[model samples]
Target chain A: MSTIPHDAPAVIDARGLNKVFRDFWGRPKVRAVQDLTLEVRSGEVFGLLGPNGSGKSTTIKMLLGLLYPTSGELRVLGGSPRDAATRERLGYMPEESYLYKYLTAQETLEFYASLGGLRSRRRRQRVDEMIELVGLASARHRRVGEFSKGMARRVGFAQALIHDPDVLLLDEPTSGLDPIGCRQVKDLILDLARRGKTILVCSHYLADMQDVCDRVAILLDGRVCAQGPVRELVRQPDTWRITLEGVDDALRDRLVAYLQEQCGRPVAVEPAGRSLESLFVDVVTRQRAASPPP
Target chain B: MNLPRLVAIVRLTLRDAVRSRVVVSLLAALLLVLVGLPLLVQSDGTPAGRLRIILEYALAAAIGLLSAATLWAGCATVAAELQDRRLFIVLAKPVHRWEIWLGKWLGIVVMDAAALAVTGLVVAALVAVIRPAGGADSQFEALLSARDTFHPDWAAAGLVRAVPAAAGDTRQFEPKSVALLPGHSLDFTFPVSATAPGGPMELRARLGSARPNRAPFASLWEFGPPGKPVSVVTSTNAPGLSMALAVPAAAWSPGGVHVRLTNPVGRDPATLVLGTGVGGVELLVPRDGFAVNLTRGLLVVFARLAFLAALGVTAGCLLSLPVAVFVSIFVLVLIASAGYVQTVAVTGMYYIPLESEAPELGWLDRVVLGVFRIMNVATAPLIRLEPVALLADGRRVAWAIVAEAGLLLGLAYSAVASLFGLWFFTRREVGRAGTE
Candidate 1:
């Protein structure tokens, strides 16, 4: 029931969203967001891509009601973003791990759970589950200030999901994360999307976005330059890539020559190796697996 | 609006105060001040004086330290969180902004109450342990008990008119302020409401001489109604010396009592002037126990600190950490100096010594005084509610005063500050860091 048809009504709908930073005299300073019209279907993984100061964070802030747009219409969960009731179903994780440093991981999640109106027993249960889910079980009792950047980000992520919200707005979710943390976060996003949670992620990690995001909108200087399904946008009709197994150097050379003869151009040949992130993750995982934490 | 969210914020605030070592440091500082202060300040060497020193000076210093710590904690709780970006998480939650302000204020108040209770207990225990042996129980009771002051009903006695002292000295004095000539007596009648407990009362008088010479003068004080003097005292006093007389309950009537002070014909022909204002002519009657008096004093002090906590939080909500602290401290200094402001407002002059050279119109002084007048109107109640002077002098801190303080300073002032803070904090742009 969480997933809707391709033409289903939009859970997040914004049209002509514009946010302009102003000076003391009300003169327009920086147009942080401009003519932003976007939509994400129910239970979809949407990515917002931009370089620094390209309105990605600004857009996320607007959706979360942290910042008001200069001129636009933004609705989250079928109501204005400023509505407190609407926020009950929305969760936001900011760019930085904005958590109380003095609170332990469990306490941090518990606090957010309470804010989300979770009852006492359920709050405690969810806090425990979140700690486990974030892989912070060992450091659950440690103060967040003492955690490393990746661990803090995990706690931040846990707090955002503590309420079991319908929609998640994450800004630079994997900025401080290591490769393993980033991989875990990506998997978690995919899992949440599978469980029918609408997730809008803003990040510069193009590969991670490509891996988990169903659709993406690339922003350049406060404007959307391209937006479509990840597969649809990245596909090329003129290029073809083929992978083969058990082929020697002579066979590989023959295949490339045949392709070039057919296409009337030189065919580029390169071995497909594992990504560095995958290699690092594999090495760390195998080492940790060989010597499991006690 | 969300009670659970409010509780969560309060709990987190208290936890931060504890984990940051602010509470521990505050307690340590208070203990050092309370226990070590008696050693530093010189007492009168008598047991009564030593006890007074502990109760008056040490307790005052402890309360001051507690107040400062409360303000610091209040500022750090809100402003530091905003600067550190922790508040962004809270704001992003479904909690209302007012809940956050109230929670932080409650946390500071609860912590303040704990500190105050502990300090009170320690002081009381110290008093119990170090009490001087063999001191008269009556003396101790008189020193420690809260006593109400009864002033003579000058208007009821038709003595409201001011009598001229001498020719060309246009300064008129109250009829009760008369200087008695030899063999001439001045009678003062005071109405006693039935509420006043009938018992032994203490009468203190400051005798002033018309002559500059200091010499012993004989005078007689008669108590009770006409021709039915229950108590009569004939005493000699050096010029300008203060004296105390004890009158038994038999001298008092349910309706009223008349006391006649007569300068009996003596070797010194100089007249004597009874003091002026409440201090000039009054009766002391004991009321509440020392414990209740101390509690009332602490309550008023707590109310003041609660107001400060709200103010600190309000400032912190708008300003960064250092700037918030500075503004809070500045406001504290202004409130504390209300006495000077009051003087300026009343006299329309900042310096009393420059009165002769002061401009007749004094436009600049008038402007400053006008501003201070408004400030004094706002701040006088808080300054006057300080119980230190009353407690030191063994006078009762009236419950009415305590109630007024709670209503005006605790509830009203804090509510206004909290509203302002919530308004500013909610509308503020938290996405930008380190903003004013």
Candidate 2:
């Protein structure tokens, strides 16, 4: 369901990016990133995959202008990422919530909305919309410091989208969420992609990423080890899976035997099962419907 | 430039300070000190002395407490957030670095203003509730009233040995000394411009002798021209003690009036060696009331607090929380010892020279002064008027002094610190992890 055209313009462009961390004495200590070249086009959900300390965060920081590349050329939204004008159209959610503990959810959203240059009336509307979007309307008046990790994450997500930015760089978008929350976040990413927003997500949750990402890059030790369309990268070319409902064991056996005889090869058949995330979402949906909030 | 954005940041900062209970604790401490300080201290048994003790010590305590808190909060604001990774979200917004700096500074200043107002009101209320006894009013009137103080025109009287300080010197750090022998008259002329024969004035004289004058003597003080003189015999002659004698309104002549103090109006003739230095012999004309004077004094304190706010924010921008706090406290110490810094700049004596010791190198003075001058960008000419002392001593905190302090400390010096902060923070990489 990728809406990206072949001739889509690049929203985030990086070429031969390198980052070398230095010690107190200005000596090169660790090469966090080496020779990275990445392009995230408009209207795509691009996922970055890596183990801990594999330069994923460093690359994202560079793209957000939080850290300078030791050597590279980077363009975000067709301009230098450090520019305020360039930042105006970009939204970012850090790995941690990183919100003011003293502020309530409503105040936090309103603060970001104002910073994004929303007028007073529109800011109120957006704050209300974002609170509802994140399912935190009941908890809007409570201080963020009192929120659980998942609730704080929800607030963080709400703030990032408050400005209605076209490009989003989300670090670990579903780090501490429950299964239903994870599914909702994945669906939200797909919905945003459908609306022509470019998103760059970094996470270790491959299953969550696989459900939404169109293209993915797997990084190891600061370098790209593998990259391509998710379908092509994860596709098993030598095997196939077929599923049919209402097939008894004898009928299934007969079909398998006929396939093996015709192909002159041994074939195996197994039952298809639903993903845990899907089942969990279904259960939560039924429970919520049974006893909805008044 | 973005008013709404800055306002948002300011509101958040203020809310943070209040919720964290830091500002509340500070306010409580200030209130206790202002109300409790007078009750604890022992005054000179006189009502005026008691009032002076309360005003001086309580106000000083308030200023000291507020200043330390302002610096501590300033240092902690940005540095703590950065360490906690809270700044990542804020910085990711479309904010220029200068706006953030300005917003935080404004927040601290607003907090200080509110704190000062509370402390001032408490002190004023204390004074009102414990009104002084009836007889002491005239004694402390000249001290508490905001008046234009005038000293004897020593240059015109040919008693001055060196060049006099220029006109409008707000704080006359040095004093003018004059001598008067027994059986001789000392004419002290004060040329003050007032609409001829102006508002009632007083002659406040605190003259010292080579030896303490234990015995009382009769001295004839004649005001105005000899043709129509208003002769008054003042007999209280404790030389070191100050005495305020009311001058008749008619005593002020067209241009100026000369007061001739002839010692020994009787046969006793106790020599009044007039050592006019510091709180010396002077004329006082009431210009404004006590409330207006206190307001002016508070304005100076506000300017100083604003400067400290900028300095603290700038320090926070460049360092970690603990390090920033240390650096800010060090700067605060330096500012607190500004008088010492000034002494080093003027006399170039880092240490008092030992008896018969050789003078240091000639270049030493230049170097010391140069260093202080360089530091002037960070700590401008603050505390020049010593508003607390002025308030306690009953001297006027002139509008000229207020304007000077405001422009230099609040506006000009703060702008420099803020500019440096903005430049460094803009170029700094806030997301830099530890090396490697």
Native contacts matched by each model: 0.80, 0.77
lDDT of 2 at B172: 28
Candidate 2 chain A lDDT trough over 10 residues, lowest sum: A1-10
| Estimated TM-score for each candidate | 0.93, 0.92
Compose the digit string of candidate 2's lDDT tens values, residues A127-184.
Answer: 9999998899999999999999999999999898999999999999998998877877
Residue B298 displacement in candidate 2 (angstroms): 0.6
Cα DockQ of the candidate 2 complex:
0.83
* C-alpha lDDT values of all predictions: 0.83, 0.83
On TM-score, the candidate that comes out on top is 1
DockQ of each: 0.76, 0.83
- Give the Cα error of residue B420 in candidate 1, in Å: 2.3
Across B308-394, the per-residue lDDT of candidate 1 in tens digits comes to 899988888888899999988877788778899888877777776665676665677678778889988878887788887788777
Runs in model 2 deviating more than 4 A are A1-3, A258-268, B133-136, B158-176, B195-220, B224-250, B265-279, B356-380, B434-436
